[model samples]
Target chain A: MPSISLTLNGRSVSGEVETKTLLVDYIRENQKLTGTHVGCDTSQCGSCVVHVDGKSVKSCTMLAVQVDGSEVTTIEGLATGEELHPMQEAFRQNHGLQCGFCTPGMVMSAVDLVAGNPDISETEIREGLEGNICRCTGYHNIVKSVQAGAKAMGG
Target chain B: MQNFDYHKPNSVDEAVANMQASDDGKFLAGGMTMLPTMKQGLAAPEDLIDLHGIDGIAGVAEGADAIEIGAMTSHSVVASSALIQSDLPALAALAESIGDRQVRARGTLGGSISNNDPAADYPAALVALGATVKTNTREIPAEDFFVEMFETALAEDEIVTSVSFPLVEKAAYAKFPNPASRYAMVGVFVAKNADGVRVAVTGAGPSVFRASAMESALDGDFSSSALDGVAVSADDLNSDIHASPEYRAHLVGVMAKRAVDACG
Candidate 1:
């Protein structure tokens, strides 16, 4: 086992993991942060999305050792106390999800989308979120939520 | 993915040493393709040599008439790079259109070209733009770098350092992306310069290839309509569930036209 330390959410934590252990597994199993869901074993789905070094990445596609000293922010870190992030609030207000299995990844990905650009169009949002797949809601509400969230983020 | 020892080498020499030491060592850049392939049990290397730790392997250097991009540079970086967007907008657009936002954030230019997937987008751009593939040992022209499906001219122990793309007067890339995977069903990259016109077709064949007919036609008339009479035969093209070789050959003509029209 190799010991690795990284900044998770806003704090620093360290753990031991095998060479092949994925970052999502390390986050969920060792660190007990289960909000980051793994919907697809393949890299096509965005269910395992997370922010590494302040940029969105598929957590399942990255190994724990690959991001040893980097900063990783999971869906669990999106809130301050009880208040939801603007993007999360927008998702809730716009009904961006149905069963909510894909919401965490969707919201995390949306937050990055909004943060990366000040002005985003509906088409860009659709193209931007292509990595994230939601079986339900048809993405109409998700697109609406992203537009509203971008506004909420002061984009 | 099976258990594999990992080494983060600080230099290209160290990485090569690590590669030579292992039974079957893989140089890992972004892990966008390699990780999933491993998880699916398609490949199982005994060792993984992570190259991200190495410095000087992840930046862009601009010359008078060319841009040298390090292998570790990610697609997102290349897509949004001021140098690339300004100097090579076609390359930037191609990078921007790869996979998706998340995949772009992690996928590297070197990995994409090295893997040489049949439907991948970079090979077409590199081949059409007449780029140079610089490895640890020697520099290879983009045309010779890609050998066959999921294979390149790179040796097992060699590592790609950077690729130098000579600036062109005009170039553009257009693709008919698969609705599901976004990998190109038929992608075309067209470039024109003082020398002549070069057209590379990807996703329509076993590997990226030059459309000599289209290039000659465009060399004569520098217009999309110039390619009206030229046609690519479906005979040697790839046929899969997503698209037939006939359709892919048709797309080759259509995408080449769009690419030529978009060229500046």
Candidate 2:
């Protein structure tokens, strides 16, 4: 087992895991953060999306041991006490979700997108959310959510 | 995924040493391709050398007439880089169109080129832009770096340090990406430099290749109309469920024309 330590959400976390243990598995199983979803075995689904060093990355595509001394933010970390993140609030207000299985990842990815490119347009929001998929909403609401979220993020 | 001893080397020399020490070792980049392949049981290396620990290994540098991108640099970094967007917008566009945002955030240049997937977009841009792939030991021209599908000229223990891209007078890339995977069904990268016009085609062949006919025609006239009658042979092109060799061959010409038009 490889001993690894990284900042999760806003706090420091440490764990000993197998070398092949994916960051998603470590988050869900070891840390007991089950909000990050694993939608597909092939990693095509963005349901495992998380912020690694403040950049959006698929948690399933990374090994926990690889990020020994890095910062990671999962879906579980989005809310502060009673209030949800702006992106999360936008998704709820705009009905950006369908079954809610992909909501956690969608919100996480959306927040990162807004942070990186706050002036993102509808086309960019659609394109930016290419990694994330929402089969039910057809992405119309999702697009609005991202646009609104960008505004809420102050840009 | 199999149990492997993971080594995070602090430097390129240490990485090389760790690679040479292991019986079956593999260098891990962003794990975009490697992790999926590992999950599918396609590869089971006894050791995985994580290269992200090495300091000063991930960044882009601007020079007089060329841009050097470190191997660990991710697709998103290249796509969002101001230097690349200003000097080589075509390369930035190519990187932006790779995989998806999540994949872009994790996939690295060295990993993509080192694997040399036939459908990969970077190989085409590299070959067309006349870039040089620098390894720890030596530098290899992009023309000779790619050998075949999933193969490159990199030595067993040698690691790709960075890719130095020489700025071209005019360049553009256009690809017909698969709607599902975004892997290019056929991608063309057209670049006109001081040397001449180079037309590199990917996804259509076993590896990225130059279109001499299109290059010559474009050399005569740098316009989409210049490629009007140029015929790309289907003889050596790839045929799969996505498209036929004949279709890919035809798309090669079509994409080349679009690429040329995009340059303007």
Candidate 3:
């Protein structure tokens, strides 16, 4: 087991993990932050997305030790004590989710997308969310939520 | 995934030494493909040498006549680089079109080309641009780098350092991506330089290949119309559930034309 330390959410955290322990598994199991879902276990689904050093990455694809000394942000870190992140609020207002299984990853990925390009167009939004699959909504309201979320984030 | 001993080497030499010491060691780059392959039980190595700790292998530099991109440079970084966009917009566009947002954020040029996935987009760009792939040991021309599907000219311990792409008069890449996985069903990259015109096709065959017929036509006249009667043989093309060999053959011509039009 490798002893690794990283800034998870906002605070510094350290743990011993197996070499094959995925970042998502470490976060969900060791840290007990179950907000991040593992919808596909594979990298195709965006359900396991998290910010590693401010860049959105598929957590399921990265080893836990690989994130040592880096800052990691998950869906749980987005909200500030009851005040939902603007993207979360937008998802709520626009009904961006249905089953809610994919919301966390969707929101995290969307925040990074909007942060990268504040003035993202609809086509760009659709293309940016290519990694996220939503079988329920057909992405109609999800696109709407991201558009609204971008505006709320001062885009 | 099988449990393995992990080693983080701070230098390319150290990484190579660690790999040599292990019974079955694999160098881990971004791990976008390596990790997934491990999870699927396709590969099982006794030791994993992580190269992320190695510095000076993950940036981009502009040379006098060509642009040198470090092996660890992520697709997102390449796609968003202002220098690359200004000088080699075709490569930037090609980088942007790979996989998706998250995959692009983590996938690296070295890993993609090293794996040499037959359907990968980078091989087409490398072959068409006549880029030079630099390893820790030596430099290899792109034409000789990719040998076949899931194979490259890399030695077990050789690490790709950087790739140098010469600035061209014009270049563009067009791909018909598989809707489910976004892997190129048929991708074409065309480049015109002082040397001449080069056309490379991927996702349509066992390996990325040069389209000499289309290259000669475009060498005479660099235009989409020049590919009117040019055709790629379907004899060696890949046929899967996603696309037929004949369909992929047709797409090679169509995508090559699109790439030429995009260059203009």
Candidate 4:
């Protein structure tokens, strides 16, 4: 086992993991943050997307040992104890999710996209969200949600 | 995924040593391809030598007439570098079109070239630019590097260090991506080098290859219209679920023309 220390959401966390353990596995299993789903073991699916050092990455594709000192933000970290994140609120208001299987990753990816480039256009949003896959909602409401979320965040 | 002893080497020597330590060991670059393959049970190595920690393999070198890029340099880094954008905008654009942002962040040029995936975008750029792939042991010309699908001339223990591309007057890359996988269904790279012109085609073939006929036409007249009659032979191209060999052949001409137009 290799011991690693890194910032999780806004808090610094440390743990020991098997060298082969993926970042998604570590986050979902060891840390007990089950919000980030694992729809596909392959990297092709973006259902396991998360933020690594401010950039969105598919946690499933990366080994936890590879991100020894990087900052990670998952779906579980988005909301305050009582208040939903603006993106989350936008998703709720717009009915962005149906099955909700791919929502956590979509929300996380959308939040990162908005944070990275606040003044994002609809075309850019579609292109940016290309990494993420949503089997439900047909992406119309999700796009509206992200657009509204960006506006709500003063982006 | 098969269990393998993992070693993260901090330096190139350590990486080389780790690779030489076991016959069944494979150097892990971006893990974009390798990890997925391991997970699918397609490849199971006895040892995995992680190469991301080696600083010497992750930088860009600028020269008066060319650029030498470390193999481990991420696609995102290549896409955003001011030097690359100004000097080789086509290459930068090609880098940007690969996979998605997440894959670009972790995938490296060396990893992509070494893997020699037939549908990869970088090989078309490299072959079109006539780049030189430098490994830890020796340098191999791009023409001699790609042997076949998922195959290269690189020895088992030898690791790619960098690739050098001679600055060209104009160049561009164009590709039709498979909607499902986002891998190139067909990609064409057009370049105007000191040696007149070279056109490389990828995704449509068993391996990335130069389209001499297209290069000849463009060499005769460096314009999209010059390729009006040029035909890419369907003989050696790939016919997969995404595209028929005939369709890929047609795409070769269309993409090459698009690249030529963009080059201007």
Best candidate per DockQ, number?
Answer: 1
- For model 4, what is the C-alpha lDDT against the true structure? 0.89
What's model 1's lDDT at B128?
Answer: 92
Candidate 1 regions off by >4 Å? none
User: Which portions of model 2 show Cα errors greater than 4 Å?
Assistant: none
Worst 10 residues of 3 chain B by lDDT: B51-60
A27-113: candidate 2 lDDT, tens digit per residue: 999898999999987888899899989888889889999778999999878789889888888988999888999888888888888
Query: Which of the two candidates, 2 or 3, achieves a greater DockQ against the reference?
Result: 2
In model 2, pairs of residues that clash are none
DockQ-sorted candidate list, best first: 1, 2, 3, 4
Best by lDDT: 3
Q: Per-residue lDDT for B146-205 in model 3, tens only?
A: 999888999999999899999999999999999889999999999999989999999999
lDDT of 4 by residue, B5-117 (tens): 88888887888899888879988999999988887888889889988888888878897688889999999899988999999999899999999888898999999999999
- lDDT, candidate 1, B67-119, per-residue tens: 99999999999999999999999999999999989999989999999999999
- DockQ list for all candidates: 0.90, 0.85, 0.84, 0.66
Looking at model 1, residue B197 earns an lDDT score of: 96
**Candidates sorted by TM-score, descending order?**
3, 1, 2, 4
Question: Between prediction 2 and prediction 4, which has the larger lDDT?
Answer: 2
